[model samples]
Target: MVVEYEDSLEESSYSAAAHEPQDTARLAINASRQDDLADIIFLANNRRVTDMVASMPHPFTLEDAKALVKRSEAGHMGNTLFAIRMKNTGRFIGAIGYAPSMEDGGACHLGYWIGEPFWGQGYATEAAHAMVDFAFSDGGISTLTASCHVNNPASRRVLEKCGFQFREQSKMRMSGNSGLVNVDRFSLTRSTWKALKAWGQAA
Candidate 1:
């Protein structure tokens, strides 16, 4: 299930530029959306999509969404995992953002998910590009890491578009489960970010 891209980006080459995250930039990232639990639950209950998620459990409810909002808000020191919303309709589509590990002070992990109804419309790529730009900007990032199940081609594509380079492949225990699953890790550094910005401008 571990799919990798032939291309690679150096962490030292991406430029760190200030990028104002816009809610209307294809997709929006929101946090502290405990009030939107009902909608979140509705989206979470979509069996068509959750079947693909590595560790997401079934029968999502309003309470589950509320707990997610609460935990995501209070868990990370930098406040990761924002709600993903549509710009035009102003409807919550899913969630996105970085999650930091206490074990790795300088590294942060990026993750996201979208409702099935919103799939295959370029929202993931758009939001991921924005998130990467925001993270690599000066005063924004030290290092960023992301991973996906080997079978998650769409997720891998999102990482590729964000200029991440494959670091390694390993197994990790899934949430709400006891077994291990294969995953591909990708990483980016600030200097590479600067270069990436320059390349983007030149292109």
Candidate 2:
């Protein structure tokens, strides 16, 4: 179901930020909003977060955050971007989503991140699970693929926990940071996801 917020942010659609709703769950995924500008900037501006994701720009700014919302809202046929929020506090911690293939392949790449401070707390795993469930159930995608820098063990664990099997190894171009880095690839097909869910529900 699509959720909506009143967007207390009064400035131009891209001018400022808003207050996240308060709840008690560990994490929740929802559409990015104009009011989330400050949190996105505060959490994503760190080098620790920026260095891991390929497309993210370093020294991330409010304008960068604004641009992201615009791009995500533009709506690719099979792509979606979501905000990872702390349920109890309504704070934006990071982002996650699938980017559709330009070739119209029945697959898309999964990507996600959580703030440095929020790491090691299982938030990434929870967010990834929600995204995977959505991709296969509502999104109607056949396959989900993801990659992690060989150096990033934390990310590798998250993808593995989400049921992505090791596919291969490849090199990825880092956005702001120049050199290419070796990345471990992983994928989860719809049939596998259904089997796993069946076992999960049975258990």
Candidate 1 positional error at 100, Å:
1.4
lDDT score of residue 174 within candidate 2? 72
Top candidate on TM-score is 2
Error of 1 at 157 (Å): 0.6
Instruction: Give the per-residue lDDT digits (tens) of candidate 2, residues 45-135.
Output: 9988888898888889889999877765664435667788888777889888888643225469998989998999988887887677666
Q: What does candidate 1's lDDT look like per residue over 6-73, in tens digits?
A: 22243432233222344545666656466678778888777655554544666666767877788656
Off by over 4 Å in 1: 1-20, 46-55, 71-77, 102-106, 138-140
Model 2 ranges off by over 4 Å: 1-25, 101-106
**Any residue pairs clashing in model 2, and if so which?**
17-35, 18-35, 23-87, 23-88
TM-score of each: 0.78, 0.83
lDDT of 2 at 2: 17
Please, what is the whole-model Cα lDDT of each candidate in the order they appear?
0.67, 0.74
Cα displacement (Å) at residue 14, model 2: 31
Tell me the TM-score of model 1: 0.78
